[model samples]
Target: MAARLPPGNQRHDGEYEDLLSLWSDLESALSVVLSAPLRVQDFPAKVRQVDRWLQDLVAHDIDAALYLMFQLASTSSVGYSASHALVCGTLCHIMAQELQLPPRERDSLVRAALTMNIAMTALQDVLAGQREKPTAAQQDAIRNHPQESQALLERLFITDNLWLDVVGQHHASISDRVPLASQEPHDRLTRILGTIDRYAAMISPRKSRAGRSATDSVRAIVGHEVDQRDEVSYTLVRSVGLCPPGTFVRLDNGDTAIVLRRGEKANQPLVASLLDRAGAHHARPGIYQTGMTNKPRIQSALARSAVAVALNHRTMVRLGVYAAAPHNSGLMGLVTVPGAL
Candidate 1:
């Protein structure tokens, strides 16, 4: 049975519809850019498209944009490169906004996040499906991917110094003994991207293992070698919360649910119940405000292996937990935002 939004919840049909359209357009553009054939000429145009989408995204409710991003991350059929780019971009945007960065700087940070892994897109996809450890050659490629990606962007006529620098330094460790004065002006942005990239990858399922629980992922980030004392790390943690969207959790009421959105409180979030107290699937999923009462609060974040249910993009869209366009109009149906072109 398809899940429905709770009865009293006001439907943001128009907003969600727009979000769906935007998501498809961005996904399609990213697919072309990341394809094996290397559409080098199309790279610049696609970045512009992503920039426009980011602009429009910030104008909407932050939570709505986040929900759309989570839906895309969970449902995308694209390989790790594209999916990671999208997720990291969204996370960077959220953190930047929370930290009150200037609009120009925020947009540049998102652009950096989106293109940071372009050079390794295909390799990442291939590596993700393998159970064995990466080969020696693959290890070398992973180590050099940041510089290689930046070089590719430069060849594509990307002239933004900040964007290029952020991509190049994304993998550099803050825990290194390098002097702070030697760090680039955009070091903060790089650190934020690095943190988000790692977090997103940890929570995303791979052939080698199911994704870590959201709580565990958060813990890993806090315990990272790079000091967590920076404002960027603090804001990233605060914005993502303990139970990020797309993570599954068990409720105090004995129902299993998927997180839909973060709440005012870090421990609480909005979730859609997939199972009832008796451990049976609901005819229609129920939405709960975990912060409203402690009785139905999230008991613990569950790993992907623990959830046996099959929830795909179409089902999530049908449930209204994720946004979707009314028809399969592809990129043409996407509404043009002012100044996007």
Candidate 2:
């Protein structure tokens, strides 16, 4: 389970505390929706509530939102299905802004991403924690989950045609070369959601195997396409840097670091080094701007499963806040508590 903040007295300030509280609340809200949609009095209203919460979190700080999302993806106590949905929905929300998608389409698109796997939520959670491959019945269920999900949503009174269509066809095979603008609305949304879904899945860990590195996950998605101008995939990478916040990496100088924020360039990001070149943990992580001249560059992405370290997330986030806006020198005075996460 993701850690929670202590009493307000123990926290440095409201900034980090509020961000962590928002993430915790979001996970709990989503857990309820995905695990038991029927239990919700108004399914559509509940969805919109979750969406607004997500928007608030993202608007507060996109980097911080991504940081928490990736952190949860690595160690989700709620369940894999919920974590995956949150990642996909969050990415879709960001991509919607990049694509300048209409508000209506963006709403349906993000809602679809959140509920696309509703039909198999229980099964997905089980599969994520199990070592064995899917049984034949499980395979059949997986193959038909899209259609089933749509039907389930309908029963829950989701009457939005665009939402229903996108959920039902999110797994459809579409030509990557076709420009997103020329495609039908449902088709375009489906393609976008599918891309994000696959990318999020590739970077999320499961009991069957360790998740791929963020760099490798992007390559696996964009490499196969012959079209260099694939709108969704390109915009996705542009919106979130190659090594997005909360992901780990090895530096050219042999230090292992965690990404804190995106830099001026997509390839370069602000990172905090946790270990030195000799593989010894630093007493306190040293922040670096990989984009700066003569600075150590990122050597490679590290899969979450590959790195085992407990971080006082509160301290790291304070450092991020200070790094993003150096004028906030007061933030640096926050207490550094150990074993917070």
After superposing candidate 1, which stretches have Cα over 4 Å from the reference?
2-15, 36-42, 74-77, 175-184, 224-228, 311-341
Candidate with the greatest TM-score versus the true structure: 2
Model 2 residue 109 CA deviation in Å:
0.5
lDDT per residue, candidate 1, 1-341, as tens digits?
Answer: 32233233235544555666777677666656766425556667778777677657746655556656665554433566777787788888888878777776787788998899888888888887778999999999999999998898888888888899989889987642333235555886777788788888887777777677767787787763334345555666678667776677999888998876677776787777887767677655666668784448888888767776766433343333332223333312222221101
lDDT of 2 by residue, 159-196 (tens): 99999999999999877789988999999999999999
- Judged by whole-model lDDT over C-alpha atoms, candidate 2 comes out at 0.85
* Candidate 2, pairs of clashing residues: none
Q: Largest lDDT belongs to which candidate?
A: 2
Query: Which ten residues in a row are the worst by lDDT in model 2?
Result: 1-10
